[model samples]
Target: MSMPGLSTGTIAARLNRMPITRLHFRMIVALSLIFLFELGDLNTFSYATPGLIKYWNLSVSSVGVIVSASFFGMFLGAWLGGWFSDLVGRRKALIWSTAFYSIMSLVNAFTTDTTELATVRFLTGIGMQAMSVTGLTYISEMFPKDVRGRYLPESPRWLEIKGRSQEAEKILNDLETEVETYLGRSLPEMRDFEPVQQSAKVPVAELFSKELRKRTIVLSLAWIFVILGFYGFSAWVPTLLVQHGYSVVKSLNYSFIISLGAVPGALLAWPITDRFGRKQSLFVIMFIVAFCVIMYGLAFNETTVIIFGFLTAMLLQTQTALLYSYSPEIFPTRIRSVGTGFTGGLGRLGNVAGGLLVAAIFNAFGYAAVFIYVAAAFLMGGFLIGIFGERTAKRALETISK
Candidate 1:
């Protein structure tokens, strides 16, 4: 149902030139809420572990098993969600995934034993990851190239690719009208641009096609290392502190205090990502975070631990936010979700491994060894992306992918 003269190129050009409007802000607010709940849910299990151990008498190894279960579920969810989104549209996929996780989280409260808890957690992980991958894909498609990090209706770009150009045109027309009404000025005319030809259907295996193979491998490895470091550190900090002889309440309180840095950390990326470019920003942040992780491990007292932990939390989130923006930009629209999901899913696998590594290392080699492993993970992740990732700031998605 494409309208004659309404090519994908025209849609892209119009979207690129559209001014930021209240509607865009509204969309950002809505999406931010989604991420807020998603992240809060992601850490709930980590926070609950101290209580589970005290009340249920769960062993540290048992806690690690539960953690791995959740990550395994996330691995499946990320891959499946991405594939489903491309097939059914981003809106539907997001809605389904969000609802799935929310219900599973509630179900989690009723579990009375380790087995039940692990099962529910695994299910919740799937939904959480699916929602995350879909939401990121939706953002990449709906926002303008120049300011995407800063802002969806159903993406006009996605619609056009799906051969629903008439609907895409209507959405663009509405957006333009809203922007013009808000500004009380006519927007500048769009420059001529070549249309990107749409593929009818893209198979998941296309991510490994000769044109994309290197990107897929490099990004997948980078994601694996980064996520391994992230989950290894964040998931274990509170539990480890308790094991180190701090009271459970003190560990949770300190973890919360350290977490206060997450918001500012994510916000700091907003300007720098556009200024320094995604690859460069990610590169610098990852290395800094690696050093912070080691320092956090070496701290001899509670104060130093909190300080280094706060710094680590902040920078870790900064890189995370940047990666969410960068990952979707790496693929063409036809397979953007699939590629993102695949890499992100592999990263979840890394988390699974991290959970086990944390347990094994903490038990076998003691405290400092665990941090060394986590630090090494971050360093590897940083080097991979610094050396191999594409520059994506201020560039059109189509241009970057090409």
Candidate 2:
């Protein structure tokens, strides 16, 4: 039997109607496993820094260098990765990035000197951002049009803009077939949305056109501050606990307790985001994080410290969920990867500054100074997004970009 041709809207409708199955479960599980390894490597320095200090008899300046090194690489990686994803393919970009970072991380674990470690970490950082940005772009590109439904959509705009209509239609048909196979029935007919016009060619400079310039700038600054706040505080949380008069082992244990909060925060963010909209919800979350950080700095009791610390971690993770979903929507499909990469790369400068700033303050002042700096970053991030970020809830990606 010949399969009937369908429109992008029909493909999206079929995908949205899919029921839970082992195939979906497997895909989610695979991504989760990859994320676990990546996150562990990303956070390794946070746990290792104190021990590295003792083992290497390191100075605060050296610690700052080690921490900032990866971010420098990340800056390069994100931009290049974005370009690569556009030029080649998302899957290849993701695979190459994953392999590069994973290998570098393993090499870094055995390094005996700060110089060697920093060098390896820099390379690893490149892979980290590349893998992350490529993966995110892939997810956005792979899905069907979200329309009024909760599921995210595939960029028909992107497909049309790139002159890939046939491929796009094929994807929709394949998805419809899969859903039909699962349901053991045919899908209901759907009216096709008018396909977007295809440009002869799209220049990268389209990202900076008058229509998009303001959005580009706002997202860039927002990302910078968000990364600054996250890396500044979380990277040093264990070390901060140690400075607060706890043993190193106890500090690690306390950090673990704080880490547990991230789970619930992530679980809660998805559903709640639709109600408040991305811009407003991010503002509230960041506001709460700043307040929690301030309280964490002032709290002298262990119980008080743990409570506020947990809240801060949870809120920060939630902010992360919102930020990622929000950021990519601001750009059209043609430059989506590059736009995301550019902002993410620009934001990574905050990570570089954050590490050095934390070291300087901790050396000259104390833990309180570091918290103040991080709190300020979070506050600024919130303000920028709340004031200028687009409301992306329940909107199509193509429409949002325009």
Candidate 3:
């Protein structure tokens, strides 16, 4: 179980070696902060929309446009970001992406019409996902394959033809170069057979053989639940708080409180996931989140509102922390990004639903119903994770992929 060459500094140096470090915790902190700011800033659009409606004479459809702009950009960004980050170093891609969103957020403040908002939001989304996903891949490489951390949630590139755009090919090339130079293996030595697809699923069954399929499915389900919890909470909580009779100020304050709590969850999740185990950590988080989300909806006092508001983040956001780390752990480096990207990007379907569906539930069924729905999603996530998820704490990364 014990290897002779692993050292803390070695890991740290690997993680922070400009493009990729072995265990660059500081870079993770830096990346997390940039992401938190972007998420916080992006959510502001929801609050900003009404004011924009009056000022710009925007239509109801325009509201939909503003919200969806970010998503459309994000899906594309996931592919491009992974390609870009893999092609360039994670650091430069991140620096540029952070600056892109920072500029776009300010531009969003000045939008005079729906088109402008959509344009700005789309660009902002590009920047946001590009930075976030690249950071995810970057962080994953730095840590030991067996180690994982709280993803505090999130995807890559392909289908384009340019040298810079061809990430999958580039990655294959990188693997070839790294192997030939370091280990004296040719490209043929590292090539894997393409597994047959069964519908839209990963055909993880074929890729790794039947024995591993059960564990792979469990890992996939864990990702789905984590995302569902994150989206379900973020989407419904504000309206639910309003339905519970809180003032606009109270609702806004509480939303900010929960988001702020996510900051610490993001910072610590990676270390916790790596040290403890992804399944065990997520199990703990899901219960805390389920309990708090229930209390946030049902409790009426000001103090209880604030306490549970912060408490809500204990796990809902922690879903993100674990997801980023765990998903990649389940695949090989060649297909790791593809595997993780598939889940993270497809999961955006849930995110899009989160923005619209929960609003409908509140509009039609009331806050209590929404609370019940969110609670069910979280509890189900906990149950699914406990039952289906794999333990990636100290296992090798290549093993997960196989």
Model 2 regions lying over 4 Å from their true place: 1-26, 144-161, 184-202
Write one digit per residue (lDDT tens) for candidate 1, span 8-121. Answer: 377767777776678777878878898898888767777988999899998888999999989999999999999988887888899999999889989988999989988998
What lDDT is obtained when candidate 1 is compared to the true structure? 0.86
Highest TM-score: which candidate?
1
lDDT of 2 at 359: 83
Predicted model with the maximum lDDT = 1
Q: Which pairs of residues clash in candidate 2, taking residues 3 or more apart in a chain or in different chains?
A: 143-154, 144-153, 144-154, 145-153, 145-154, 146-153
Candidate 3, residue 203: lDDT: 34
TM-scores of the models, in the order given? 0.97, 0.90, 0.69
> What is the C-alpha RMSD, rounded to one decimal, of candidate 2?
3.2
Native-to-model Cα distance after best TM-score fit, residue 53 in candidate 2, in Å: 0.8
Global Cα lDDT for candidate 3: 0.57
Per residue, candidate 2 scores C-alpha lDDT tens digits across 96-178 of 88888889889987898989989988998898888878767755545443422122223334554566668667655665577
Candidate 2, residue 17: Cα displacement in angstroms equals 7.3
Better of 2 and 3 by lDDT: 2
Per-candidate total of colliding backbone pairs? 0, 6, 24
